[model samples]
Target: MNNSIDTKRIVLAALFTAASFALSFIQIPIFPAAPWLMYDPSGIVCLLAALAFGPKLGAAVAILSWLPRVFLDPFGAPMGMLSTCCLIIPTAIIYAKSGNTRAGSIAGMVFGAALSIVAACALNLVVTPLYTAVTMEQVAGMILPILLPFNTLKMVINVVAGQVLLAPCMNVLHSSKA
Candidate 1:
């Protein structure tokens, strides 16, 4: 096996991942949605990691971030487990290349939200058939009604919240020289 990730990268990713998990506990109920798809600045941290490092770091931060959440509160169902992996990596990658400037982060977030919508659509298709009690057609129909819109909402929420909020937070962290 060729295991070659740098130690500093892993440590950073672990820190980011831990931050991601910790952020979940500070929840604000968004409505009737269970587990209430949230606005986590942690995504900002994950995005920052990918921005500072690269996709490998992004994936590590993303996957590691979700593991504890799954054990703690697997939302919607088992199928939704993969949704975590699906949503954040694209967000991470988008943020990484664009972090060269503030405008770049905004542009990347717009693109990232669109990417998240696509990933969410695909996850619905792949997971719904296995988990839903209805026929595949019914599952598709029922889920499409909520899944697409909720995902779009999630992406947009992430993009807007991440850009407006996480950017400043990240800036403060980076500027502190800690």
Candidate 2:
């Protein structure tokens, strides 16, 4: 493991980031329990990194996953890129550092889900009011209650999926350890 930034690592991470971005953009549109909610696989890509690599790599890859989204989307920085950082990086670190045991997987999921809920609420507090007038603010409040829970569910779903799939992924990762 090189301490400083290696070009190889950077390029590989860029590929990971691209995979994540592609996953997020590919909207398969699962039936979300909440209004205007959708499930995506990008978070799984980030978790895959955490399981295969270490915390620092996980964090960096997580950041890469969202940076392009922040730029390309219309509602760009309103949710605060920092909020995404808060949710994804720590979750990745927790999973990476724990060495991906069953207990650690659950703990990581709980941490990530809770963080996502908090960040959504906080960002909505600021971004919601700014994006719309008073009439829209009322709608925003109504929307938040519906949406937050669904986001939490997404975290839970991803964690469970990762836990089930980790062994297979690890096998593939291991074979390439040349």
Best prediction by TM-score: 2
Name the 10 consecutive residues with the lowest summed lDDT in model 2. 74-83
Leading candidate by lDDT: 2
Model 1 stretches with alpha carbons more than 4 Å out: 1-11, 25-44, 69-99, 176-178
lDDT (tens digit, per residue) of candidate 1 on 1-178: 1347666556766888888767756665443453444444455556666655555766577667766766665543233334444455555565656645677667666666666666666665666566456466664674556666666666666667666665566675467443
**Candidate 2 lDDT score at position 3:** 76
Taking the tens digit of each residue's C-alpha lDDT, what string does model 2 give over 85-171?
Answer: 555566666776777676766677668667866776666656666656634456467555665666566667777777787778778
TM-score of 2: 0.76
- Candidates in order, TM-scores: namely 0.69, 0.76
lDDT of each: 0.59, 0.65
